[model samples]
Structure formats: C-alpha cells, structure tokens
Target chain A: MVRYKAVIAYDGTHFNGFQKQPNGRTVQQEVEKTLQKMNNGEPVTIFGSGRTDAGVHALGQVIHFDYPQERPLERMRFALDTQTPEDIAVSSVEIAADDFHARYHVVEKTYHFKVQIEKPRSPFRRFYASYFPYPLDLNLIRQALPDLLGTHDFTSFCATGGAIEDKVRTIYQADLVVNEAGTELTFIFRGNGFLYKMIRILVGTLLKIGNGRIPADSIPEILAAKDRNLAGPTAHPEGLYLAEVKYK
Target chain B: MVRYKAVIAYDGTHFNGFQKQPNGRTVQQEVEKTLQKMNNGEPVTIFGSGRTDAGVHALGQVIHFDYPQERPLERMRFALDTQTPEDIAVSSVEIAADDFHARYHVVEKTYHFKVQIEKPRSPFRRFYASYFPYPLDLNLIRQALPDLLGTHDFTSFCATGGAIEDKVRTIYQADLVVNEAGTELTFIFRGNGFLYKMIRILVGTLLKIGNGRIPADSIPEILAAKDRNLAGPTAHPEGLYLAEVKYK
Candidate 1:
C-alpha cells in the first residue's frame, strides 16, 4: 500500500462538517465516496488534519489516505477532482513518505474570521461574511489582539465542559485587517493541538471588545481567570474559515 | 406625507427578488411587511429602481416610500434593520426631495458578475457566486470588450419577447477583472434603460468569445444583425449583482 497526501478545499455550507456522519452527509464522506466509486467501490478511509464543525469552511485543508494500488499523482488528482462534488475538490495529490500522518505531523494552522459591519448588507459577500449592524470599534478589537498572541493557557476560550484538561497552546500571530469591504481577523496558531471551540471563543471575546461590552485590555485578565464565563459568546460558525495547515 | 429614499442590499438566495409578488415572499415584500408591522399594520407601497429577477442580488438598489407622519431617518433605519430578516437590510434612509424618482432619475447603472473558475468551492461564497469548471481565457474576452461599448443596437443581446421595443443603448464600459481568486467581470452602463436579460446575454456572448467558440471581433456583427439568436445563452442569474445606481 502507498500513502498519499491530498490538499483539499470545500464549501461547508451544504456539509455537516469535515468528518463523516452516520446520517447526514459530510465533506469526508463525499471525498471518500468519490474515491470509492473510482476504485469500483473499494472501501478506503481518509485521515484529516483536523475536524471543522458544521457551517465552517476551509481553503487549504490537508488529508491523507492509503491506496492498495499505485497510480501517478496527476492522474489520481484529476480523477478525484472529476469525481468529487462541485463544492469539494482535491486540489493536489502527492506520494507521501511511508510514515507521514496528516494529524500527527501538523506544525501549525491558520483561521480567518470575516465580519461585515456595514449598515446595508453586502450582496456579493453575504455568504462569506458575518454581518453586524451594531457599530463596532475597530480600535478596541485591534488593541486587544496582541494579548492573544504567544503561549497561553486557553481554558477560558474553550467551550464549557469539554474533555480537554490541558489548555496550553502557542499562538504565533493574531492579525486584524480592516478595509472598506469588511474586517478580516486572522489567527495563526502554531501549537501541538487546540481545544474544542477555542478559536470561536477567542473571536467572541474580541467581538465583545469591539462591541464595547468588554474592556479592550481585559483579555489577559479573562485568560488568567480561566473561566469560560469570563469570555464572550461563541461567534457564528459561518465567518470562520480554516485558511491553512502546515506540517513538518 | 414624508418621503424617504433608502439604499438597500440583499442576498437573493432566500428571496424571490426585489418586487413584491401577490402570494410569494420577496425581498420587497419582506421589507414592506416589516414596515407595516412597525406602523401598526398600516400598509405602505415601496417603489424600487427596477425589478431584479428571482435569485438575482443587488448591492446599491434604491427605493422610495411615503410615511403618513414625520419620521426620523435614523430611527427608521435602525428599526427597519432590526426587524428585517438577516438576508436584507436598509443601509441608509434620507428624506428625499418630493420630485425624486427611484427609476426615472437614474443616470447610470453598474452590474457585476462573479464566476469562480478556480478549484476549491468556498463555502462562504457559494451562495453569492457561480462556479465554472472549465478554464476561461480572459485575454480574448478583453479583446472583444471594446466592440460592445458605445451606443449601438443591442437586439442580439436582449431577451426576446420583452416589453422594451428600443434596443439601442450606450454601454460606457465593459471591464473584465480576472485574478487568482476568480473572474469578476463588471459592466458599467450609462443608459436611459436596458432590455430584459440584456446584461446576461452580453455576458454569455463574452464567455463564448473567451472559450474561442466565437471570434473576438464578431461582436459588432452580432450587434448589427439585430437578432436574439446571434448571441449565446443567458448567463445564470446567481452570478449577477446590481452594484450601484448613479443618479443626477
């Protein structure tokens, strides 16, 4: 058997998420189904770098699978792309080193949150952005961004009552890009792993700061408190996008 | 009575378009319903710049409505925004001069068409854009663009059996912007009016030219033929957006 790595992108609007579900359809199921159909219904399992919840999207998601037979990378890539649904595509395929594991070899990941604070909704960017009619203070959000970078115990940001006991993670960068079109907040985290709903919670906290509900400099205190209630509400999943995944 | 002009925007995915239908739900109907609810069930007829077809979105659509009593623009704007569904919003409201007509006073209209030619469907942009698998040659489309500009007969690009009899109109600009993200082609036409499906048909003709199925220079001949069959199929409405309306 040969191990192959595939770079993929998917629209999560019509999907239940990245993983396969017992009842509802999913991105992984769709990709696996396409591969199965190509191999005459031969069952194959794919491993992903991480799982995204429902309504979440991805631009550069990485995954790997084992095939009983060997084929050229270009042919496999084309076949997978042709067989996949319009919402999902296998962008690239390559033969992986025998021990390459999609999840275990991960070094970092980046996610983006798009917010449209205009009075009138954006016709073209409606689906891609979260609209907030309430006036947002961009300066406050920017002021609080630096507190999120670097290593920290992120227990305050994780969802309440998760199985995760260890919440330490390193954040390489937290960048905020505000333009006339909209506000795009990007987070680049280089960590061993992340807790459940961690990124969403972090976004919620920052949005609260923008909304003036929380003080701009209260992020460090909230983190130090290590209480989920100290953070802001969990943001909508539609605005969050898995932008990239890095592996060593 | 006090009259106010509103700049509106909506995502046409869940709406039936700009006009209010007898029984069907439309963006106009929804806004009107919200207005009536705000006014204790008092009905008000709202007039828009033009009728946008079902599934066609708008960014800068202008509308005018009359209120029985004096109302603050900020209050109405905020109330309408709060009451309207997430898909629609009233961006701005200004007390217009009594002579302001949403349709009659329009000097120019700008429309944008987005085609996602890249691999990877963006979940966030799925509802706002159309995906095309085949690669498009934008250079050829650009070469054919100049021929369509200026005042001339455009019967070949207008939908057959429409209400308009005059097909002659001036097209100020037909700009094509292609990048790594996707193809964003915008047409800024300065005309008195447009025929039904004229823009869609023009896009289809340009797409055909881009695909090499039609010669880039044959645009003038197609226009002079004054035949609907001379043009290609109408581009899908999902990719179309009314970007703005310029009023003098």
Candidate 2:
C-alpha cells in the first residue's frame, strides 16, 4: 500500500463540515466515497489535517490516505478532481512516507476571514463574506492587533467544546487588509496552532474594536482573563477560510 | 401612483429566472413579493428590461414598477435591498417619468459570458463560471469577432422558443477579454437587443472556433444562412450574465 497526500479546496456552503458523520454530507465522506470507487469496492479511509466547521471554506486543506495500488500522481489528482462534487476540488496528489500523518504533524497554519463592509451587501458575495454595514474605524483595529501577536493562552477566544488542555499558541502574524474599493476587509492570521473557533473569536473581537463596541487596548486583559465570556461573539463561519498548512 | 425604476443584481444559481412564471422561484417573484408587503398587500407589477433564462445571472438588470406612494429613493432602495433574499440586491431606486417604460425605453444591453479554461476547475468559481478544459486558441476567436459586429439578422444564433418576430439587431461591440491569469475568458457583447439565447449561442460558436471544431472564418456564412443549426451549441446558462441595460 502507498500513502498519498493531497491538497483540497472546497466551497463549504453545501457541506456539513470536513469531518464525517452519519447525519450529514461532509468533505471527508465525499472524498472517501470517491476513493472507494477507485479502490475496487474496498473501503478507503482518509484523514484530514484538521476539521473545519460547517460553512467555513478552505483553499488548501490537506489530507492523507492509503491506496492499494500506485498510480501516476497527475492521474490520481485528475481522477479525484473529476469524480468529486463540483464544490470540492483535489488540487494536487503526492506520495508520502508511511509514517506521515495528516493530523499530529508539527506545523503552522494560515487563515483568512473576509468581511464585506459595504451597505446593503452584495448579492454575489453573500456566501463568501460576512456583511457588516456599520461604521468601522480601521485605525482602532490596527492599534489592537499588536496585542494579539506572540505567545498567548487563547482560552478567552477558544470555544468550549474542544478537548484541548493546552491553550497556549504562538501567533506569528495578525493583520488586516482592505481591498482597493474599500468595501471589503480581510483578516489574516498565521500561527503555530489555533484552538477551536479561535480565529473567529479574534476577528469578532477586532471588529468590535473597529466599531467602538470594545476598547482597542482590551485584548491583553481579555487574554489574561482566560475566560470565553470575556471575548467578543464568534464571527460567522461563512467568512473564515483555512488558507494554508505547513509541515516540518 | 409613481413609477420607480430600480437597478438590480442577482446570483442566479438558486433562481428560476428573471421573469415571473407559474413554476419555480424567480427574481421578479421575490422582488414583487417584497414590494407587495410594502404596498399594504396590494400586488405591484414590475416590467423588466428583458427576460434572462434560468441559471443566468445579472449585474445591472433594470426594472420599473408603479407604487401607491412616493418615498425617498435611498429609503426605497434600502427597503428592497434588505428585504430580498441574500442572492438578490437592489442597487439603486429612482423616480421614473410616467411615460418611461422599462422595456420600451431601453437603448442597449451588455452581456458577458465567462469561460474557465484551467484544468481541475476551482470550486469557488463553479457556480460563477462555465468550465471548459480544452485547448482553445484565443487568436482565432479574436479573428472571427469582427464578423459578428454591426447590424445583422441574428436568427442563426437565437434559440427557437422565443415568440419575437423581428430577429435583426445592431451589435455595437463584440470583444473577448482575457484576464491577467489567462485562465478565464470573458466574452462581452453590447447590442441594441438580443433574441432569446442569442448571446449564449454566439459564445458557443466563438469557443468552437477557438478550439478548431468550427472554422474561424465561417461566422459570415452562419449569419447568411440564418439557421440556428449552423451555429455552435448554446453555451451553459451559468456562464451568461446580463451585465448592463442602458436607456436613451
């Protein structure tokens, strides 16, 4: 058997989430179903780098699976790409060491959250971005961003359902970029790891700061509090994206 | 009663079409439903610049409707914008003269057909673009575009289901624009008016020429024959967009 690693991208609008469950259609189930077809009726299980919540899109989610036979990388990629639903795409396929794991690897990740700041939101962007029509002060958000950099225990930002005990993670980058038309804001975050819903909460808190609902200098206090209630409400899942994953 | 003119945009993936029909949800039905709520439950009829087929999108579709009261234009625009589904947006509302008709006063219309040439189509663009993974020579398409400009009986390109008797239309522009990535081709056409499925058929024929399935120089012959069968197959509706409607 050969272990294959693949990069995937999905729209996430129609999917329940990246994980497989009996109740709803998911990215894992879809990919595994397609792989099973190619495996001559044998079941093929695939492991994703991590689970993305429902309605959260991904540009470069990683996965790994073992196949009974070896195939050309391009052919394998093409087969998976054409067979899966149009909302899911297999971008690349490569051979991986037997010991390699999609999950449990030492890595870094990058995420992006998009917000449409224009009034009366755009029809075309409704699914891909979160719409915010209120007045926002970018300078205030910028002032609070530095407080989020470096190592921090993100218990205040993490959702309650995750079983992770260690809340400390290193944030290498946190920045906001506005499009040329000034109608869209994109939040970028690169970190060694992220807790469940952590990025969404960070974005929500930053947006609150931008809109004057939260103080610009309150991030440090919020982090020190180690309480989920101290953070802002979680941003909508539609705007969050798993952009990249790096393994060492 | 006052006539209100509105510029509308919609993502047509979930819509039946732009016109009101007995079956399926349409953009007109949604807008009319909202207008009815605003008009004390009285039905308000709207006249559109033209009908767009099911699954075809629009960026600047024009419509005019008579209302019982005259409200601020921005307020009217906002009311309709927020009330409609997330896929539909009312961009602007204006007071129209009593004699100004949405369909009759139109001067020109711009339509765009987008084709994705890249292999393993991007999931994010599946709904917004038509994927064609084939070798296409853009120079051949460019060479044949001029034959489609100026005035001509476009019966060869019009689908047969329409009841319109006149098939002659003046084509003001026929251009193929390739984005910087060279992965997408946008076929833009501005004309006095278009018969049912005319723009889609034209794009289909142009893409055939680009791919060498049809001779690049046969456009004039197709126009002279005035036979729909002579034209290439009609392009997919998802790629077609009614981009703009102009009034004199």
Candidate 3:
C-alpha cells in the first residue's frame, strides 16, 4: 500500500465539522465516502491534521490516507476533485513516506480570524466574517498582541471539552491586518500548537481589549491566572479559518 | 402614504431569484414578508429595479415600496435589515418623491460578471464565481469590447424568454478587470438597460472570443445580424451581479 498526503480546501458553512459522526454531515465523511468509491467500495479511512469546528473554514487543510494500489498523482487528484462535493476540493496530492502521519507531524499551523467592522453588515460576507458593530481601537489590540507571541500556558484561552492536559504552546506570530476598504480586520496567528478554540478565545479577548471592555495590558495576568473564565468569550466560528498546515 | 426607496444586497446562493413566484424562496418574497409584518400584517409589495435570475447576486439592487405610515428612515432600515434573512441586507433607505418609480426612472445600471480562470477551482469561490478551465486571451476580449459600446440593437445577446420588443440599448462602458493574482476576471458593463439574460450572454460571447472559439471582431456582425444563434451560449448566472442602479 502507498501512503498519500493531500492538501484540501473547504467552505465549511454546511458541514457539521471536520470530524466524522453519525448524526450530521461532515467533511471527513464526504471525503472518505469519495475515497471509498474510488477504492471499489472498500472502506477507506483518512486522517486529518486536526478537527475544525462547524462553520470554520479551511484553506490548506492536510490529510493522509493509504491506498491499496498505486495510481498517478494527477489522476487521483482529478478523481477526488470531480467526485467530491463542490464545497470541498483537493488542491494537491503526492506520495508520502510510509511513516508519515498527518496528525503527528511536528511543525506549525496558521489561522486567520476575520471581523467585519462595517455597519449594517454586508450580506455577501455574513457567512464568511463575524460582524462587530462596536468601536475598536486597533492600536490597543496591537499593543496587547505582543503578550501572546511567546510560549505560554493557554489554559485561559482554551474552551472546555478538550482532553489534553498540557495547555502550553508556542506562538510564533500574532498580527492584525485591515483591508484597504477599512471594513474588515483579519487577525493572523501562527503557532507550534493551539489548544481547542484557542484562536477564537484569543480573538475575542483582543476585540474586547480593542473595545476597552478588557484592559489592553491584562493578557499577562490572564495567562498567569490560567483560568478559562478570565478570558473573553469565544469568537464566532464562521470567521475562523485554518489557513495553512506546515509539516516538517 | 410614503414612497420609500431602498438599496438592498443579497448573496443569492439559496434564493430562487429576485422576483417573487408561486414556488421557491425569492429575495422579493423575503423582503415583502418582512415589510408586511412591519405593516400590521397588511400585504406589502416591493417593486424591484429589475429581475435577476436564480443564483445571480446583487450589490446595490434598488426597490421602491409604498407604506401607510412614515417612520424614521433609520428605524425602517434597521427593521428591514434585522428582519430579513442573513443572506439579504437593506443597505440604505430613504423617502422618495411620490412619482418616483424604481423600474421606470432608471437612467443607468451596472452589472458585474466574475470568472475564475484558475485550474482546479477553489472551493471557497464555487458559489460566487464561474470557473473556466480553458485558456483565455484577455487582450482579445479587450479589443472586442469597444464594438459593444455606443448604441446598438442587442437582440442577439438577449435571451428569448423576455417579451420586450425594443432591444436597442446604450452601452456606457464595457471593461474587463483582472485581479492582482490574475486568477480571476471581472467584467463590468454599464448600460441604460438590459434585456433578459443580456449580461450573461454578453459574457459568454466575450469568453468565447477570448478562447478563440469565435473571432474577436465578430461582435459588430453579431449585433447587426440580430440572431441569437450567432452568439455563444449564455454563461452561468452565479457569476453575475446586479452591481448598481442609477436614477435621474
């Protein structure tokens, strides 16, 4: 059997989530079903780098699966692309090392959170961005972003339900970019790892800080406190995106 | 009674069209339904600038309706904005002259058609753009656009469903803009009026000329011939947007 690694992109609006479940439609289930059809009705299991919650989109989500027979990479990609739903696309496919694991690879990930600050929210962007009607000070959020740039225990930023005990992770970058129209704000984060809903929590806290609800300089104390209740509410999932997954 | 003119926008992915019919959900139905509720359950009807086909989006579609009461414009806008589905938004509302008509007083209109030329189309754009995998020469399309300018009979570009006999229309502007990445093209057309599916047919003919299936200089002949069979097939509606409507 040959192991194949593929990069995929999906619009997650209608999907339940990335993980497979019996209740609702999911990206994994759709992809696996397509793969199984390609494998002549034999069950095919695929592993993703991580699970993205419902309504959260992905630009370069990575996955790996083993196939019983060898085929040209382009042919496989074409088959997968044509067979899967239009909302899910296989961007690239390549042979991977037999031991390569999509989930276990040691590397980094990048996420983007988009906020629409325009009043009377745009209909075209309603499903893709979170609307924030409150006034925001970008400088305040900029000043507070540095506190999250280094390795720290992110217990306060994690949502409950994750089974992982260690909440410490290294954040390589945290930055905000505004579009030319000044209507949308994109918060980009790159890290070695992220706790469940960590990015959403961080964005929520940062926006609160920008709006003066939370003090701009209180990130350090919040992290030191290591309590989930200390952080701001989780931001809406529609605006969150898994942008890139780098495996080394 | 007061005449209210409003500019609305919609995603149109789930909408049947801008016009109300017996079957399928439409933007007009949603807006009228919301307005009726606000008008004490009295049936309210909205007159749109024009009808857009299924899957065609809008950015600045204009509509006018008569209301029994005069409420604050902001309050009316807010009520309509909040009550309509998330896919539709009331951008602006104002009191208009008693004689002002949404469909009759239009001086100009602008429509935008988006085409994605990237291979293995991006999933995120599946609902908003038309994917063309063939090779296209933009210069060819640019050269042919001038033939479509000035006044001309556009019967060849008009779909057969409409009963309008006067197909002569003035083209103010016809331009093609490529995104910075060169992966997408936006075709903008400003004209006094358009017939049924005119923009889609024009885009289809333009793309055919760009791809060398038809001669780039044949636009004049097609317009003069006034034969629908001479033009290319109508393009997909998803890429078409009713961008703006103007009033004198």
Quantify all predictions' global Cα lDDT against the true fold. Answer: 0.80, 0.93, 0.95
Q: Write the per-residue lDDT of candidate 2 for residues A106-172, one digit (tens) a residue.
A: 4899999999998668888888998788889999999999999999999999999888999999999
Instruction: Output the better candidate (1/3) by TM-score.
Output: 3
The stretch of ten residues in a row with the least summed lDDT in candidate 3 chain A is A119-128
TM-score of each: 0.89, 0.96, 0.99
| Per-model tally of clashing residue pairs | 1, 0, 0
> In terms of TM-score, how similar is model 3 to the real structure?
0.99
Show the colliding residue pairs in model 2. none
User: Which regions in candidate 2 have their CA more than 4 angstroms from the true location?
Assistant: none
lDDT of 1 by residue, B57-125 (tens): 888789988887778789989898778887786788899888888988888888887766655454445
Lowest summed-lDDT stretch of 10 residues in model 3 chain B? Answer: B118-127
Which fraction of the native contacts appears in each prediction?
Answer: 0.50, 0.88, 0.93
Q: What is the interface RMSD of each candidate, in Å?
A: 3.1, 1.0, 1.0
lDDT of 3 by residue, B149-196 (tens): 999999999988778999999999999999988889999999999999
lDDT of 3 by residue, A100-129 (tens): 999999499999999999968998887799
Q: Which stretches of candidate 1 lie over 4 Å from their true place?
A: A121-127, A131-140, A180-192, A210-218, B22-24, B97-100, B120-124, B132-137, B179-187
Clashing pairs in 3: none
Reference-based lDDT, residue B131, model 2: 81
